[model samples]
Target: MEFGGMLSLDFYLHQNPDGGALLDWSRRLRIAAGAARGLEYLHKVASPPVIHGCVKPSNILVDVKFCARLCDYGLHFLASQERQGLAGYVDEEYWLNKSGASKECDVFGLGVVLLELLSGRRSDYYQENVINIVQWALPLIKGLKFSELFDTRLAIPFNIEPLVRLARVALACVGNSRPNRPCIAQVATILTNLEMDLY
Candidate 1:
């Protein structure tokens, strides 16, 4: 259960020399897919759904094999109540409500994290842009211009099929309306399919 060192998403992204290689892309997909599955289990498989109020890169841990394990469940709250913690990661719709965190909020945060992984940039870096990564990336994705949206450091092929799929998932996760967001299980399924295609 213990990784030798504390490996946050930032650490993994920066420390790895081959950040843009295909192998690295596969690794990222695995990590992200694992995180999606973890969230899926929490929402659908658990007896009582647990809403991970905070879903950021710092909270996602990487193991020796580069597998992802979500941590810091201490901030998890019941889906039925209003959220009371972490402003930046929380969905705007649920920000002021004290009713407690919900699955949709977590999904929004997950979308932000996924954008960071793909962009090799921090979420805060794009704060001045008014819209978050999802908003920034959607237009490019819809226009089939991934080269304009993808991480410049990464040499993802021009094929763009996988990148499109990933972008779609991210868009779904960060939908402005909670109901428009895909459930964790659906996100997991999409990511799992993308991971298999990577192999």
Candidate 2:
């Protein structure tokens, strides 16, 4: 129930002692894989299953080894508060309906977090030329320009295949249709495979 060396993935993604990305391509893949496995446990292995309403980088905790432990998995049990505007990481359906967030919403949030890991940008903000990280990176990914989609603070990955595969998985999770989205279990398997293939 307790863990040490707890730090948000947001910190590792956006902050560094040397003023660069704390995680490079390999570390990013490792963390992303770990996160997917944890989510798979919640969505499939746990009895009765569970939904992590918040799946952004800020909610993903990392240990010294950068193993990801998703936090706030139980927040859905708390009563809903008075209405506020949508959070940037929330799925569009959840924001529009003011309804309960489901596993699919969590999928959407995870996609955004993956996008952040790749781009070193927050999901909530729109850059001047691009609407958001998803929009900004999708074209770059599709165009096979891995260098452009990667975090500029880090050297471009020597092997870009894993990053490319990971980006495709992220995109599969981000769409508006819940039914069309890949389940967390599938996403987990894909990420885990990508991790194994890296080494």
Best by lDDT: 2
Q: Against the correct fold, how does model 1 do in TM-score?
A: 0.83
For candidate 1, write residues 1-199 as lDDT tens digits: 6868647775666556654453366777888898898888878887777777788877888887878888885365533343333545667777555654688888988887777777775565334557656667767767878678777776776566876788778877775678788888888999999988977
lDDT of each candidate versus the true structure? 0.74, 0.78
TM-scores of all models?
0.83, 0.88
lDDT of 2 by residue, 136-181 (tens): 7777777778777777888876677788888888878874478899
How far off is residue 76 in model 2, in Å?
3.1
Q: Candidate 2 regions off by >4 Å?
A: 17-21, 77-86, 126-130
